[model samples]
Target: MLQQETALQKLWSWLFENKVMLLFLLICVGGVAVSGNSASFVIENVAIRFGRNAFTVMSLLIPVLAGLGLNFSIVIGAVAAQMGLFFAVDWGFNGVMGMLIAFLIATPLAMLFGFGVGRLFNKMKGSEMIAGLILGYFADGLYQLFFLYILGGVLPVKTESLIIPGGIGIKNTIDLTGNMKYALDEVKLVDIVLIFFIIIAVISVFRIIIKLKNKEQSPLKDLIILLLAAAVYALTYVPAVESMLMTSKLSLLNVFLIIAVVGIAYAIWKIISNKLNPDPKFKAIRYITIIVAIVLLYALTYIPELEKILMNSKVSALPLALIAGLSLFNAAFLSTRIGQNMRTVGQSRVIANASGINVDRVRVLAMIISTVLASWGQLIYLQNLGTFATYGAHLQVGQFAIAALLIGGASVSKATNKQAITGVILFHTLFIVAPEAGKVLFNNAMLGEYFRVFVSYGVIALALAMHAWQRKKKPSLELPA
Candidate 1:
């Protein structure tokens, strides 16, 4: 009884520490369950949303590192991206070249905006969040003025349809028919899958080779697992699975067999290698996980209604590649002296200053980097969307992106790429499923929209309150700036 109680206490403590993640998890599960949507449907949209919003959410990290809270001025970066994109469209530049040009144009603009925001944040140190938020609105007004009145008149826009009828301002809605649509989504699905499988097989083989050098695993068992995985993949050449996947159905059995067989093979190898504990509870839990996973495949696959909703669950290679690049950049950035200085300022400006670091410059650089990333992110997003609302596209970017970050368990003072990616998945899961769930329950999709809106603001509010409460409790440990 005492042991059980101790275990429960540990669980509760972990939940408390990760409450944001836990709450989002619950919301996602509830949304999925109530919506009665197919897993593929939810996953497809979530993956796309991850690509759309992950970079922007990540952009908030540097500003957070500098203790600037959520950089609501990231919208300024979006504004910059839009201006670049506007010109690219006007210049009749299409495909990849247009996107690259947009990025080049947005770079200087984002840096300028970011530098200004950072300087202002330094002046309003303790209230950086509010200042950033207010600055976003102020910047929006300028963006509107530029787009609505200055584009054709001041800036030479040659494209006729891009500008309004009176030839003064750009159009409210820009059709990206010939310009940079799907700029990051041009992928051949089967080729991508082959590449993925090749990478996985190579990694697995390398791991096995290393283990063999150490005499850790049964080579026979590892070989059997490899053969089994290869056989399952060979089924893809059968034309049945290919046709099925090409049509995009929720074939749970197909997915489960591929996963379960691989999992079983690995598990058996582990046991044979003496790597896994053969205890009763451990064995029972492991078998149950396998069983439940396979059972779910059959159950979900048999449901006819679910089949109707399963959409094309294909992954875009470019977005995944870009995400990997950004993650690597973050890791590399954090290993540098500038990164250490950024961290020091985030901890306490006084400490950073005492250590002979230029705190102000570090903060400005952080913001500048964030803004540049955000600008690129917006470009990626617009290309994916294919068309965009010229006047209102970037309006709520900072709010939703920050909300997603906070939902992933980030705070005002600290964040990570892990948190950003996780938050994008969970928040977008809710974003995708909640409306369908709401329509099923209340017959009103608007209710779900309102709920999502409230959630965005509510999360920001909750995070701020928590930050304040922590500050008040640790008054002695107050960050000196």
Candidate 2:
């Protein structure tokens, strides 16, 4: 019986590790059933949403890495972004400049907000999650006060449109139509594909360099590299592939901004950052897998059955570049000195302390980083939406972001970039189909809305419960006896 129980436990652990994939499969089935022939439309929406929400979800990674739980105070970061947008509007900054200026104004403010939140988290320690949630609400009140009264009443305001009719408070909705709407998604597909191709080549070269440094070689890696080279050659000759690549693009300014913020900046940082000393064989395997994927993507473009479904559908705001950058950052950050410290702090604060690791400082830095990322993420989201809700936009920010992370298979104790990405795709796919499904099944779309909210909050609660249960099951480790 004891052996059987131990075997069952191992099975459960394996299943939980792949929980994100399982959840995605279930969501995909429900999506197809509910949307029926409209599945493409649902897919389109998910693609667009991926650009909007993924960054915020990604922000939760650092804090979780440091075992500080989710950073509920990221809502404060969203608020900082909002404040920047407001000021940008007042300055009459339009188009690309408007969004850029907003981000510029928000960065410092977000850093300031993050610093305070980090300090507070350090003080609270074990109660960080509950405290952070409460802190968000408290900050919300101050945010309301600042926008509602302080801006128009005390601070000098130049823009009449930003104020309510009474000229005493900020308006309930600020239109961003004149500038900043779909600002980052305005490029032609040809231009976008050119960028993607460049990315593929760079990634391929980077992998080769890493392998050379490690003095590792694999037959599979050699095979995939050859295939990618073939794909690159094929792409050079294929007009149809070029045409498909131009399907979605942001404006020139948005393009420049994205390249700067999500591309060049990320590249510069990665170059400076130390990589994890992964096993040479593991590193070889990782690069080989990626190279195979590149080869497969190029191959997929030719297969008639999949070409239309995969390449020709035309997703307008996928923000593939930004996604790549964030994924890269998350993956690479894990191998740094700080990243290792985060793991140490996460596993056992006592051990970390004995190892001379400053657990509290690491946790604070994690919160600050999460806060800054969340702020920038909200900026990305609003640019796509082309408008801002003056009062309640940030209200559900923390809840939704947290829910998406948890649904992705992230728990209080563990998460990864892949899990975060998977969760956003599944949760948002479900979000897209649930209303229509609810309408079709129950004759009311509101049922779907409520259900979505319920699922979001429910996922968070379930994750917390599972974490507690796992803790109870895994007895504490004993020191060398």
Candidate 3:
């Protein structure tokens, strides 16, 4: 009996240690097994579907890192992305050009809205997440007013097709396939841009590891890392590399390979140069060169493609995922940082004041950022669906983003980029497949939608419960007498 109990304890300890990987593996296996005979088809279909969804999921990364609690305001970015799509479609902007133009158009709106949300979250402090969540709901009402009523009645939307048959209101749904459909995926421009972002993330991780390796060392390693990063950017953007990318299959794998080679070469070059002479002034020049090179390369690659596509495609209600992802990331990160500061102020405004951090500034920033992310999120969502359902479209965004984040393993007080991505993938996978999974077993597709909703909400509840349980487990030491 004693031996059995000891073995059971050991098993429990092992499971706890490998919990995240174990859970992820379980989800993958369970998802596949549920597909039964069509599992391969189902897996591939879902994975491709995931690519369609990845941009939006990635949008939540910055906000989570900044501690903003899922940026419920991502709807704002979505909405702004929609406006760009709407105009692009109206003007007959096709494919890659439309995507780029739409992205450019959405940027200003995302910044404005994100700033507003950041301010609001800053005011709420400890309740930033909940505050942002509610704010998203309020913004939805405003979004509906603009999208459903104002645009057709007073705003003079140029395209007749966008307005309703009544001629005084917008339609319940607008088809956007003609303008901005699959712009990002279809555009075969510099594969390095995609790889650049991924490599930046990798280099970021490597820098962290290096920091841990030599905490006692001088700040020289940072300069080396920065120089390497810049070199990678410069090498990847060299005009000659663009031709090579053009010949290769325009796939994510190809993009990744190019980025890996560029990063390796850049790292080696920087390491050798730093060993030869470590000057801060030279380091700054390297940084500037990398930034300029990347900018020039991106412009050289996408500008022409965008110009050509802007002349062709037209989609009214399109999903501008590419643009929204970038905007939301910035907004979420800013708001999260401001909100964290606000929490510190809330814990003791006097101490925070003494430290010279302006509480009001933090609050304002939080509000702005949150609002911007929300705006972009709405835009991306509307464009992707290719239509808007009057009252129903924006209604679920706050709940969905929040629910998705929590489902992915986020909490009210803390979250991470990995959690946001993992949650969205799993949540979306379940969302995409649940209906079919249900139909196969129960012969009813509606059951699948209900199952998805139930699971989404259930996941949030589970995360909250787990967080509370974890908090309870922390032993409190009595104050010394």
Query: How do the residues 1-481 of candidate 3 rate in per-residue lDDT, one tens digit apiece?
Result: 2233466666765554334434644754675567463543444444454444544555554455444555666666666666666666656676667666776787777777777777666667567667766776787778778777777688777778777787666676666676654444444434535555566657666776677688865546665666676776566577787565453223323333344556456756775687699865556456446645655654543556443432233221123234334545554644665555656654566777888888666545544544454554554455445555655665566566666666666665555556665666666666656666666667677776786777667766666676576557433311223
For model 2, how does the per-residue alpha-carbon lDDT over 120-161 read when each residue is reduced to its tens digit? 888887898999899999999999999989998999789997
Off by over 4 Å in 2: 1-12, 20-24, 35-37, 187-306, 315-318, 473-481
Q: Who wins the TM-score comparison?
A: 2
Per-model TM-score versus the true fold: 0.73, 0.76, 0.65
Question: Candidate 3, which ten residues in sequence have the lowest lDDT sum?
Answer: 311-320
Instruction: Give Cα distance to truth, residue 408, candidate 2, Å.
Output: 1.4
Instruction: List residue ranges in candidate 1 displaced over 4 A.
Output: 1-10, 187-312, 466-481
Clashes of each: 0, 12, 64
C-alpha lDDT of all candidate models, in order: 0.79, 0.76, 0.58
State the TM-score for model 1.
0.73
lDDT of 2 at 63: 89
| Ranking of candidates on TM-score, top first | 2, 1, 3
- Candidate RMSDs in order: 8.5, 8.5, 11.6
